[model samples]
Target: MKKKLLLVLSILLNSYLLSAQIFTVNNIQYNVISTNEVEIITYLGSDTNIEIPNTAESNNITYQVVKIKNGAFYQKGLTSASIPSSIVTIESGAFSSNQLTSVFISNGVLTIGSDAFSNNSLTSISLPNSITFIGDSAFANNVITNIDIPDNVISLGKYAFVSNLLETVVLGANLENIGESAFNNNSISEIVIPNKVTTIKKNAFSSNSIENITIGSGVTNIEEGAFLYNPVVNVTSLSTTPANLPLSAFDNNFNISLTIPENTSEVYANAGWVDFGSVNGETLELETFIIDEIEYSIINLGLRHVEIENYYGSSIDLVLPSEVVHEGSTYKITEIGDLVFKNKNLSSVILPNNLTRIGYDSFSHNNLLTITIPDNVYTIDSYAFKDNQLISVNLSSKVNYIGNEAFSENVLTNVLIPNDVKIIGNAAFYDNSIRTLTIGSSVQKIGSYAFHSNKITNVTIPDNVITISNLAFYGNKIKNLIIGNGLKTIGVSAFNNNLLRTVIIPENVKSIEYFAFDNNPVSEVFCKSSKPFLYNDLFANKNNIDLTIPADSYYAYNDSYWIGFKSITDGTDLIDTTINQIPGLLLISNHGTISNNLQEYVSLKIYNTKGQQVLNNNLNGIYIVVANDSLGNMVVKKMYVQ
Candidate 1:
């Protein structure tokens, strides 16, 4: 009985050994995990292109190949590999030390062990979304240029993807940790860490060309030398609490600007975060955050409003987000900070709807061809859109201020200053190709060189303008000019170098400085001022100009400057009876009959209160009539239209 029991035990042990023994099928080695399941152990075939079979025939039974064992294809001269969908695991050194340039990982793969595909020449690799774990040195020593980690990946092992040629890296949203030297020695310029990653091991991103980095909110600890030998310029941290980082983490690169959450500068400073370059809250006077690559600052906490601070992206056409959410609070973007998008080479940009102000040099030095200022924008600061390629600009109706050189050096063909603007800054529209310009009715001052070097043909200084600074409209092709009634001072060379043939100075003019109207071929001058305060060489060809003054005002023009004109005329018969009129200008009856005593006028135009020309001259409202004569003489009068 004892011998028979011993024989049964020996036979059972032999049967178990046969079922689990290593076997070969089609020059491929395999080990049986069960009666119906097997794992690939080694490849004995001498082929450069490898296709591992999903099933193996052993002992007249078929078994499914589900995993690649350790060192299965190590040191094999493989050029390409096609992994089967049934493969769930690839153990350590499965395909290491090969010359693989192409690899197709199937969707069923869940894990890649240490050095699985290391020491290869792969230029690119597509990681399947099914992968959850990547062991140490899995894909190191490759030539890949870019990488998009699978969203399902949770663990990235040490030395993974090291010594590659990566330019851009997009971390997976669910990744929990970054191992030591994970992405060392790459060419990555920009990287956005997902919110789930909490740990960054030592030398994780060392020796990379990273310029901009955005750390997620979940990151708590960064090991020493994690970012060693990197020239990082801009860093955005979403973590409200400062992360623990050694001074050697960035390897003496303490000049990187840091942007953090609102009102957290004190904590960051205590944590040595201020030891780096300027902190946004402390230096920039505002707490900043980044959303979708655009940096924004919290301007008003109670109102939840933000201002765009900077843009760290490489897109030619950009559309700014209207609002952003940070730390469970929503903030409406209402302004653009100084130098936000300067020199970005942008072709087009769409401003946010709620944006109310544009800061200095906001969009300067770009390739923008057209821009439409939003209706809510109230201010455009100095050099806001200077040195661009703009062909057309639509000013906001609510704009109240335009700074110096705001639209300078552009190719603008037409510009309409909205009615609310009060002042035009010096050189505001200088060096532009403007052909038509409309000064708003509320403008009180025109700064020096405001409209210089434009192709403007006509100019009508509205009734509210009080001062025209030096060189205000110089170097323009202006043929007709009508001064407004409330003008007090005309600065030096204000209208010099224009193609003016006729000039009409209003009654309220107090002073006309030297060269105020120089370099103009003025054949007719109509001045309604009864007592001209002071004057200099105001006109280039004053000896050939015909001066027309009020009928009883000839006594005031007896001075040497006024007598320099070729002729002075004062005829009382040209005056209107019902109105305090200038001689030889116009006569308007209560029934809106506009007739001038002089028959030299060739063309007549009528404009309403909003500066729009009307066809019918017979209307019962206060209107402005502009008449031009054959001799290039012009008369502008306010009359009743019926």
Candidate 2:
């Protein structure tokens, strides 16, 4: 405990100031990446069990251990180790040649460096979905029986899993490059490569236990000797043309049947398909058709629904069929594939009711003016409608997520975020012209830059919102804001550059970050916190603003930050709170009486032929009611006779 607790002090000493220093806990040294932020750099303990904490404390400073640096845990002897979610990278040879039978890598890790876990004794390992790259020889010579790469991963580096005892390997959906000899000596029997992969480098799977393989439609190249040695019996390629490959790609693989998509057998026959034993074509429930000179591929989602695969159109108003017929199958379009309209000159498009999911960047950089998202859509992936000239969008009420930059840089003037959304991703509404936004009661968090640089004038944040992240409403001309009570935190610069005159903060707030309301001409702040909360330069006072707090909690905001206000008080009443709004006009009440608007009359002045005060609140019948509002707008009305 001495080693661990003392390091906490080291973190707090400089972490907050963006300062850093190395520290040791339990003889394991950590390099301070920031204050209370660290990366495991050396393992000095002689223990057999290793547990890396998500948080490390030294001197009251809580450090997030975010990385395991290169060669940090390269030494052997320990049999088990666990890395926490705070970690992001496992550097080259970080845990090479370990005797561990178990290692848990959390989803926060983005890269497993070259030879990071080679020659490990682990029988099973789970790489979380956050992984993007498995570097050269990363997990080679391991005894793991199976592996499932996450869909976000892009590259499997050269010899990544060479000589492993892997019998099952599921390639991720987004993987683009299988580097040279990535799985050169694995025992994988068969593999279905996802369609997104673009290249299988030379000798990528040479000398494997593979007997069959299915190459998806997206692959464009098969380098020499990609399948040099295993006794491959059947090969299925969905590409309409033969992948760019050398004659030696399958030179040694004899007695193999090469199967191509229907109508593609002749295309591959002339491009080294004969190197295999035979070539044949199979119709696998997928077809390409020309719609307005654009090539489209469709596949059945069910007996009735279909999904659009690709769009190779140049410039047109694409009208996807509500129902398309292919191979005697009547299919209702249900989804639009990722990047379906990316970088295209699609002027307009219509979606069918059966459509549900709009994939990432589906309509990004398009010239669409208005589009109707059908009711059934539940997910609007990141960048789905980004950078469009869309002035109108009819979003489905059922959409649960407005992804990062979903409608950013659009011409939308207003948006009513539906009730089902739980999270508003970062920069979700950046640079939009939305003057009015209605957040449904179900929204919990407004992410950073979610509404920055908007023209919103007034808003009432629903009571359900708990967090408003950094720069959420910065650069807005917000004049009237009614903050909710459920809020816990206001991130740095959350509402900077607004035109607020006064704000009554909720009582449940606990934290306020740096410059949360800076760059504004705020006149007053009514704080309700009984216990003082952490504060920063929240005020850029252009005029005197009364810092009002509860009488019993005067000391709560009696700090340096609060002292910077023009004046401080605990008074709630007698403060100007009305705005000069458009007059609703005088109307006779249903009760045959008129309610008076005396918001401006702090007190009454009377005159009876000689400037004499007369009959204030003591009048009986028909005395004239005269008063000015908080904005000094004078009014006169005849009172009712009781």
Top candidate on lDDT is 1
TM values, all candidates: 0.47, 0.46
lDDT of 2 at 406: 88
For residues 441-539, could you state the per-residue lDDT of candidate 2 as single tens digits? 877678889999889998788886767889999999999999987665678999999888888788656457888888777887888754455467677
RMSD for all candidates, in order, please. 34.8, 23.4
lDDT of each: 0.81, 0.72
Query: How many Å off is the CA of 382 in candidate 2?
Result: 1.0
Error of 1 at 90 (Å): 99
Instruction: Let me know the TM-score candidate 2 reaches against the reference structure.
Output: 0.46
Q: Model 2 off-target regions past 4 Å? A: 1-304, 559-561, 571-642
